[model samples]
Target: MPVSSENKNGPYKPQPIKKVSTTTVVNPGFFAYTNLTGCQPYYCAEQVHLINNITVTALTIIIRVQKTSAATYHGVANNFWTGYINSNHTDNGSQIIYTFVLDPTQTVVASTTWYVEAQMDLYGTSQVTSADTYTVSVTGGGITNSYSGHF
Candidate 1:
């Protein structure tokens, strides 16, 4: 039997359109403590606020210390000394907001031992006799924040 070309095409049905979504990481909100003083044993203590909606695997904290130009202190480093936060901690994604102190005298507090280390010795040697200033910057979750302090 021979087939005819006419009426050879089959009926077509309309297909539903599918939607596509793209996921991207969002930056978190950061609030720094502007007023910090190193009067307590040559170490300044302050808390930083972070509002995150996504997981932050690695966070970097940088602290830079420098003696003020008007400072007449000796036996201390007059230049900028930088410190970093080198640790393995992951911030889970959530709607909850948390704050942490930059320097803590005790490692464990209320069973939660999370704190940043910005010791005066890390900045320089001896005591900070005269006025000194420090700048701390934190970077994580695609955002960066910074603040200044004095002693």
Candidate 2:
């Protein structure tokens, strides 16, 4: 038997992959404060914008600390939601977002602990300024938040 022209077109071909990588991180909200004088004390009393859909108590805040610029985050946790930050996930503004399974009934309190780190020397000119503004930041729920304090 003779074959038709359209039937001999070989196997079907799939389309190409189209994935665009993002390189920019934008900040929607920010938190700022001042630490008068202390020695690596656990930083606390920081406030974050409470989102409607997100349950505050169920979600844990992944924190990153920086002295001068928004880079080089290496600090220890000193209070609730405590954790250390390191050089990981370079593309996500040096901060990592860790999603957690939380109870819906859990109610999150405002002005909770933000960050806790050993008192860093502020006089050093290498990577710190006179005030030593330490920035603690997190990104989630389509919102970017940061807390700055001078210790």
Candidate 3:
């Protein structure tokens, strides 16, 4: 995805495009960043949008989470830190689960979207003083997508 315009916020703004390459055109609902909500300045959960681009059939999607920064932080499950897909979709806590099963054997169709939320507490001595960068990546259906932000 490329930002094609500018706003008061600055450059690199996310824009909608129908063509990705000379041979390929974007699908009807393959939009990713339309629902993206970027990072907060401090002490807040950050969200990023994930989309399924494969239209052949429903496939299981998994998001691998990673966090790094010059600062340090501590994450305690069910406390200051938590990760989950949005309420409209099903999810599991221990592992990244984009549970789209309407029934036992069914999964969400392609072009469906989900948002992953992650938050943590700055417990280390340098955590509050430095910046923390969180990155998430997902690979499935021969396509890989990733996003990163600071908090």
Per-structure clash totals for the candidates? 0, 3, 0
Estimate, for each residue in 35-124, the C-alpha lDDT of model 3 and write its tens digit.
Answer: 212233433333334455553222222222223422122221111012222222222332222221122233334655454444433233
lDDT of each: 0.28, 0.30, 0.32
Ranking by TM-score: 3, 1, 2
Candidate 3 to truth, TM: 0.33
Winner by lDDT between candidate 3 and candidate 1: 3
Q: Encode model 1's per-residue lDDT on 56-121: one tens digit a residue.
A: 333433333343222221111111112222322122331111222322221111211122323332
The worst-scoring run of ten residues by lDDT in candidate 2 lies at 1-10
Per-candidate TM-scores read 0.29, 0.29, 0.33
Candidate achieving the largest TM-score? 3
lDDT of 2 by residue, 7-94 (tens): 1124323221121223424333223233222222332211111222232333333222344433232322233332322222222543
Off by over 4 Å in 2: 1-30, 39-77, 81-111, 120-131, 145-151
Residue pairs in clash, model 2: 40-118, 40-119, 78-116
